[model samples]
Target: MTIAPQRVVTLHYVLNDEQGAVLDDSRARSAPLEYLHGHDNIMAGLERALEGRQEGAELTVTLAPGDAYGLRNEALVQEVSRAAFPMADLTPGMRFQTPGDDGPQIVTILDVHGETVRIDTNHPLAGRTLHYRLEVLSVREANRAELVKGHPLSADVAASQVEDRKVP
Candidate 1:
């Protein structure tokens, strides 16, 4: 079946950066990615590219910074009091997931001063072009539960387990 809203799609992908450096490979992890189509579960550019594809389809797509993670926002970089962090050893390049205005956001440490820490909230891949080689493994109608959750659910999860499951 063609990929569309309320459908679950399973695919393997190799993701690369503009420098042609491999960033991620689903095959290498021995796991295929599964998501609910039209639910914002994957990158917009990638979802658009797979819109009309069916099982066994293979395609390559390239996305600009805007289409992928979006351009880096300078405003996202700011300095907060070092006391804000519970950790004593504040070092550059450390990443932490913190609550954001929208949801969970990744904060990357740029520098640590005597009493302030500079952090960047932009996504790690922000402002970079990405390339993707995708192979569709399967496409099927999403079950009622999956559709309501807005993503694919593990087949091995029992009904009771699903009710208690929390995605973080």
Candidate 2:
């Protein structure tokens, strides 16, 4: 079946950066990506490109900063008192997950000073163009449990397993 809302899509993708440097390859990992269509499970631009495609379809797509992880916001970079962090051995490039206004956000340590620490809340891939080579593996109607979770579940998952997940 063709890809559509409430459908589960399985695809292998080779993600590359602007200079054609390979960033990720699903095939290399031996696991294709699976997501529920129209559920905001994947990037909007990618879903738009994959919409209407059927199993066995293959295509390449390019996404700008806004379409991908989004543009970097300078305001996301800020300095907080060193006492804010619970850890003592702080270092540059370390990442921590902290509660954000929207949800959990990754904060990357940029600098550690005597009394303050600089952190960047922007996603690591923000402000970069991404290229994707995609091959559609399968497209099927989402099962009742999958629809409830708003994402695809593994085939080996049981009914009890689905119920155990803390799905909102």
Candidate 3:
């Protein structure tokens, strides 16, 4: 059946940057991700792509910077004094969370000078297009347990429920 709103779905995905650098992949010795559809669990573009797809389907989609993260803004880059950061050793490429207009935002260290630290508030993937390779492993009717939990029921749990409901 095609993926529909309010349905629980499970899938594996690989995400890459414009340069083909692997950002995140569900196939890296980890379990497939599960989430309730239309709940903002994944990227907007990805959610749109899975709207009408069924199980065991594979799709590759490319998303622009605006659709993925958003274009980088130079104004988001700020240089502050090293004293602002409590860490004794501040290094470039290190990321830290700080307050922003909307909420908490991650800032990456761009450069570390004698007593000054330059940081960028933009997302690391900002201003770059995103590429995703996804595979829908399974899509079945969500049972009562899944509905109650607001997510997909685990395989073991689903099996146990089936066995419990069997006639003697």
| Residue 73 lDDT (model 1) | 100
Q: Write the per-residue lDDT of candidate 2 for residues 85-157, one digit (tens) a residue.
A: 9888999999988899987889999999898999999988899999999999999999888888889888777
> Against the unseen true structure, what C-alpha lDDT does each candidate score?
0.93, 0.94, 0.86
Clashing pairs in 2: none
TM-score of 2: 0.89
Report the lDDT tens digits of candidate 3 across residue range 1-168. 778877878899999988999999998959888877776667788889998999999999999998888899999899999999998988889998888888789999999999999999999889999999999987666777666666777779988978988999
Clash numbers, per candidate: 0, 0, 0
What's the TM-score of every candidate structure? 0.91, 0.89, 0.78
TM-score of 3: 0.78
- Lowest summed-lDDT stretch of 10 residues in model 2? 157-166
Q: Which stretches in model 3 have alpha-carbon errors above 4 Å?
A: 140-168
Error (Å) of candidate 1 at residue 12 is 0.7
- Backbone clash pairs for candidate 1 read none
